[model samples]
Target chain A: MKTSTLRPLGRRAGDLPVAMVFLLPAAVGFAVFYLWPTLRTMYLSFTEYSLLAPPEWIGVENYQKVFGDRLFWNSLQVTVEYVVINIGIQTVVALGMAVLMHRLTRSGLIRGVLLLPYLVANVVVALIWYTMLDAQLGIVNQALEWIGVDPVAFFGETSTAIPTIALVNVWRHVGYTALLIFAGLQAIPKTFYEAAQTDGASEIRMFWRITLPLLRPALALVLVLTIIGSFQIFDTVAVTTKGGPVNATRVIYYYIYEQAFQRFNFGYAAAVCVALFAILATLALMQLKLLRAGETDLD
Target chain B: MRRTTRLTAVATILSLALAGCGGGDDPAESGGGTAAAPTEISYWLWDSNQLPAYQACADAFHAANPAVTVKISQFGWADYWTGLTTNLVSGTAPDVFTNHLNYYPEFAGKQQIQPLDDFIAADGTRTDVYAPGLADLWVSADGKRYGLPKDFDTIAVFYNKKMLADAGVTEEQMKTLTWNPTDGGTYEDVIARLTVDENGKRGDEEGFDKSKVEVYGLGLDENNGAGVGQQMWSMYALSTGWQFTDKNPWGTSFKYDDPRFQETVAWWRGLIEKGYMPSLAIARSGTSVNDGFGAGRYALSTNGSWMINTYYGYDGVEVGTAPTPIGPSGKRATIYNGLADSIYAGSEHKDQAWQWVKYLASADCQKTVGDKAVVFPAIPEALTVAEQKFAAKGVDISAFTVQIHENTTSLYPITDHASDVSAVMSPAMDAVLSFEAEPSSLTKANEEVNALFQ
Candidate 1:
């Protein structure tokens, strides 16, 4: 009876062009900004476009050059290292914060204060960290001096530079990630905790048995988003180190930036962008499979 | 869910269409206009300090040629490169922009800049009217002039008078200091003795805890920016008889790998190792080397001549200037770098752009701009007026004039991939200064950088 009544309403609504009105702005934006440039970049990846001259078809030569270049490989390694280490640290730290926040009854003020770092722009965050970590007059070094420790070269030493940048990245995102996980934790039913406690489970046992299982969906979402965000890490490196201290901080995006703008090798840069996309796509697929396995484990 | 998906698709299409239409109307597209309208030429420069002088030149030019309009825009040095590169790639570059000799070759090689041979020929302006070797700075091997000489700057040693007096050294005594590679001439001896603390501890004094020093004798950062790295290295290396490149314009063989080059790096490093100079980590903490000197933390700093006005303004700090200390080669040299006005090859108002360039080169514009005493004119004849103007301000800029005559060399020509080489070498240079790596490792660093050239 309900279906019969709703069928004509749906048909009439479909005929009213409501969806077009709703989707028009986004469609225009995507087609004009994202879709066209993405398609153009894809096409140019296979050609020789030097900005001054018209593009010429060069097949897979740009891709070949990208693969052969040592700097490209180094950039890839740096990007992967940055993504894996940063995402790992961010997840552990954020999840720990989430767990702590979950236990606290006073949430609003603490959560708001904790999320302040996330609210700051990346450039501002980089600048703040840069000033704090400056070896000479920075407060960090001054503190070290007070403690009778010799000042260590943070950005000046290549060994410590990448890790310092990664740590800053983790610090910037941990608050936001923790907030997301905390929201996920909030959404879990209190009855499930009661049930676990009633069944002779301790607080630790309840978390492992009931809470974590139910939080799989949220975990999967955060994991995917964090990985994608980590892969696009350019702003921090650019503002903080400029991929320096002997190229220790140079990520794939910075490399692409150098090739296209600094070196005027647009075709090669496009090829690099395509390679990055492929890497991200593969990682996303693997994440999906892992999430599926996680779901099955919950069942 | 179905309705949301359809709505999103429609919105995406609409947005794409709008963006596409907007993209077509770029500055480069409007660059080509009919001869009927008054021609508008865009000018790009980075320094806000010189904007007034440039604008004054523009106003003087427009007074005579009322049909031309000059649009001037400013960018920070870093943003200037990023914007220029992006605009060049997108075919929307400004009509006329400032060019540096070190970064100009890449644009000239790519033909992104229009050669001004015909324009120079038609205008009948003699390049010799400019400073000696100024015209060659912007000319490629093919004899194509890519820019018009704007002004030249050379490095000078700026010293604090109070610090020198505290060490019982007079200005007359400083003039007698000579230099050689091994001992750094009289300049090094004086600097080592003059650089002291409350306890009478000098930089070369044994049992001096470098980490505990309250004041440094000299301060210089080792990062790869225009100031300390490029400018100081050019002065030091050139003084040591090092060439940025071999005879071939595109060659990289003559770079930092040479033993003499290593000696120069080592000597500079010794300043820190011996506690004569502040540690790189501390020196770089300030916004600039000049800032350290201005704050009274360092007795001496080396920088370009244009910063005299900056030093004069600092209270309680009387400043004096001299040429860089001579190297082992018994020769003192300063890097002579000049800026130029370049027209984008893609501009539509090419004819009008040449007129603006011509007017900037005229004696009247140079005189008016030089009278402001901000920048010395590229025109040699207009320099006397600039000298008088600066003298009236109680600043002795005669060091620049004397240095130009006594010890000046044109900066190395722009290399096609100079920025790339810089990107590669900067970190290595930083490593050496930070004491994390041996100065000799610069050889390996050079090889690694040269590999990028191929």
Candidate 2:
């Protein structure tokens, strides 16, 4: 009797159009704003469109030229360097901050203070940091001079421009990464710590074993997100270095922006955009797979 | 299964709520009317500094054409172009707008702005009344005018008087500083003497530490929109017999590979290396060089005629004006940049837009704008009035007008693919200025720039 009653409800009532009616708006919005534009961009990658003029079909030409362009190659190299440096710094800094917050603060005040920088707008933060790091008049250089060190051109020289911009990105995002990691730390039960204590494990040993193993999911999420953000680095570089001192800090996104808006080469810029999307998607998938393998090993 | 359905329902409701809320308020009414009604046209401009003057002109325009009403709107520089481009594609752009030479070439070629030759012929427009080359700058490569010339600009060297005097540099010496392609000539010597170290030593001194500069003798305008680095290097290179291109108005190739340009670039960058000027890092730092001059951090700055008010606005600083230095050709050179008004191709009120642009280029509107001495107008009759107004205000702008009067000005290089050309040239120029590469290294970059045009 229970099977017969449940079957009729599942077969008949489930076929109602109410749910479809409810979901129609969101489906329309998704198609209009996101999905259609993305597909159009991919299509435009195969054409020659100069913003104002109607698109002219030219298959594979933009892609071929973009691959051969020296500036595009430089921008790609700079982007990879930026992503690697950023992820490395973010791992150390975010993990350290999370550990500090988990051990020292109880009321979440410390986490709030740490996450404040992340909440500030990127353009505002860029302007603040740009002023603070001035060679002659900046507060950072002034402090260094007081300590008997020569001034460093953080954003001006080719050797330092990419790293400096990466560090700024690290500074902006590390706080939020730590907050997430702290939540992960909170999820690990206190009983594990007690058990480790009973085993006479040192605090450092307990941290390496119990704390790190439990926090893997959060750390993986943070790493993947930070890598994606670093690869799309645009606003801070636009405001600070303007991809300059000879394109040292010109990341892939800034290059796309210049090609699209400044040079009005919409088709070439679309090809670059598609290329970046492919790279980011591949990277994210690899990271997830590696983490999945790690999870299986732990199981 | 229940969670997914509930989440989908929530998203649906949220999206509907947002979509409904967004259009709750309509865009403010701009006074639309029927086709037979009085013609109402919109005019857009970017400069807040010149808004009041143009507003005065608009009032005069309304008085002259009682049946037409101009609705004026002003936007900040970046917002103006971005918004214009958006409106351009949507076919909702202003009927009349202020156009820039940097953008007008592309706009004309793409037919985003209409040619005014027919309107000019109908009005019997006298282009000869404007400044010598000012009216001609609006003529495209195909010899059709798209804009009516409004005003022009020239560069000059602005100095802090007390700082120069303290460094033992005279006003006469400031005016006479000359440059050569190789040695940097007397111009460099002046910069070195004015540059002081923290240890009270000069840049020319034997032990002066470049790592510890108290003040930079020369201040660079950071992130100049034009890659030519107008105030800093345009005069120096042009005066040394290096042309921007092989031809003018619509040249297909750039001459950045010319050795004269390369040599001048090297000497200019050498200032950063020798501690006579600030590093590219410092120059790119957020503060404007104008502010540095105001704070006594920069002894000298190469500024344009448009910034006279900005120099005078500085507190506790005595501003001094001087002509640009003589160069290898034994002549003083400056860029004679002009501004103009244009009609959008998509406008329904094309005839009304033409009338506004013509009035802006005429002696009537030009004389009113010039008599205020805020800017040098394009009309020649208005030039005298502008100069007298400057003299009356105790601000002598002869440093700027001298270029126009003496006819020693080179036109700003207008050509196809300006933005792409700027992209290649600016970074190469930045490398030279930062002391990372020699100026001759620009040869490769120049080749890349020429490839874009081809």
Candidate 3:
């Protein structure tokens, strides 16, 4: 290994100006579209406003109310349940597929088939899941009946609605996650596995000791993403159950939408959004620290 | 990558910091200020079902008022409200738009809609010329008319004639069917007899298989009509003297706690326990109510006159219409609701917009709209024309008009916080339908609804 140093790209005066000129259009577009809306939402959280009137500042009253509101608490509980279930299923399926694909096939067709669902739009996936899980009309329950099993109320009962929704989410996201992990697996040095084999290490033991330790960065990434995606879930619940069978599947983001858009409670919805932000931000920080790659000194 | 991200974040902050200073409320006098004799006005409506008829109306209006041009835009139901709210905030609202009673009160309160009393006086318009109680619905508590009578809707029972024949029920009995809150009167008997089991037994039989019902007697759909159940339980409750509120157009509180209302809900929900109605879970989603009805699963359905075309569109089915049954109060009741065209308060071409709305409410346009035989127009003469047109289509729409002519309609609830009230009640209503809560628990829901007004 040779000792190396990194150089800054923007050090030269002429280079900085040229680079900025090239980047201005995209940066300006992002600022106008994304940054402004985000700041506006943050500012609105401290105010009580309807679409018809100007915002009136109440200074954290909306936040206090949200913490105390029954619906807010219910939706938060629902979101936590969904996140746990979805992440659990997605991680397992992703890791399993990654390990299996790493050991077995390199077929382009198989890889393409695995990547198809991740590329399908959320609306199409939700529509397919809803149609397949429908209580009376679904093919899933029909197949169950053909196997001499009782029909299941997948989207109807409270005990099953959230899990059923989580499963659909997993089905859509697992392929992408597995592909990401598979990429990480490919990047791992082949020498480590060979060294483990020289030591008479079993495949399972080598995977546990060598593969898992080095896969931390990718796993952390998948975990953080799974958390964010789980919290942001809305369309499936909206189209499938509509938070129904007595609000069994009313996730936090869906609740925020109903309050802000449907009920026009912009301030309270913004408060809920802020709470969600704090959670996601803290999780991201924790994951970053835990998953930072170890560095070896150059000789 | 880190340096680039930092640069982008800094640029974003700078842009927002600059943009923040210029952001202000949308000013009202942006468009249509000084009309050079003739100006084009924008009109928006939610119903694509009525778009063509209104497009024709716009054409004729351009003919009558050659100086003025009207442009129409149609949006889906959900998108329409979202777009309208956004436009109202941005001061880009259409010069004229169709308004619902459910949303108009909030608009009127916020002064987003213009009061039309001055125009009404200038044009010498007679609100009485339209259907009774329709023009009154547009009058606010401040005694200003904000809308003109455009169209009215009433609920009636649509039945499958073949199903009735198989069940040995006659059309005459259906026409004169009466109901009572206690045990449901003769209506319950008819519904039970119409209900059939997989074992080929009627609901009235001793060994009827309630668990294996093949065909339900009633169609309980998810279309709650803003939770008041215009198509389902409105007739049941209204005929039992259970008004949604003490007064409308600005009622202070709801009366969901009323024992009469509770009894009506309980009786309606009992149909599910008897397997005469589909379970709430099954009815609330998955399939459209009309589709379920057409599939021979529902022998009868409480449907609005607006959906007559939707039902008749189903092939190989003999559709029949009958008036709602009479109740214990010695009167049959229907929820009388109407839609209207209202001019936006911020519109600069108020005069031109008024001219368009005036013509829309006049006999000329209303008659033409009625001749299309799509919906029941609000004007009496237009309704007459519509009745003849519907006869030409071989469907008797009189089942809907009878409620209006007999004056058996109680107005649907109209209040300032109608949206909030609906939010508080819908979940509770769902709970009640799902048997998660008792009907009497609506009193607690009433308290929550009343608290919003407080």
lDDT of 1 at B62: 80
Q: Model 2, residue A236: displacement in angstroms?
A: 0.9
What is candidate 1's lDDT per residue for A101-122, written digit by digit as tens? 8865556888898899888767
What is the per-residue lDDT of model 2 for residues A1-299, given as tens digits with 9 covering 90 to 100?
A: 77776675666778678888999999999999989988999999999988889988999999999889989999999999998898898879899888888876786677788888898777666666776676655668779999999887677667887888788878888989888888878878888889989999987898899898778876787778778877888978876787887788888999998888778888999999998889889989999888752462133
Window of ten residues with lowest summed lDDT in model 3 chain B: B21-30
Q: Which stretches of candidate 3 lie over 4 Å from their true place?
A: A1-14, A194-206, A290-299, B1-38, B224-227
Reference-based lDDT, residue A61, model 2? 98
**RMSD (Å) per prediction:** 8.3, 8.1, 8.4
Which run of 10 residues does model 1 chain A get worst, by summed lDDT? A290-299
Separately for all candidates shown, the number of backbone clashes (residues 3 or more apart, or on different chains) is 26, 0, 0
Candidate 2 TM-score to native: 0.90
For model 3 the TM-score comes to 0.90
- Taking the tens digit of each residue's C-alpha lDDT, what string does model 3 give over A135-209? 444567668878977556677666788998899889998988899889878877888889989999998998898
Tell me how each candidate scores on DockQ against the true complex. 0.31, 0.33, 0.22
| Better model by DockQ: candidate 1 vs candidate 3 | 1
Which lDDT value does model 2 have at B246? 79
- Give me candidate 1's interface root-mean-square deviation: 12.1
In candidate 1, chain A reaches a TM of 0.92
Query: Which candidate, 2 or 3, has the higher lDDT?
Result: 3
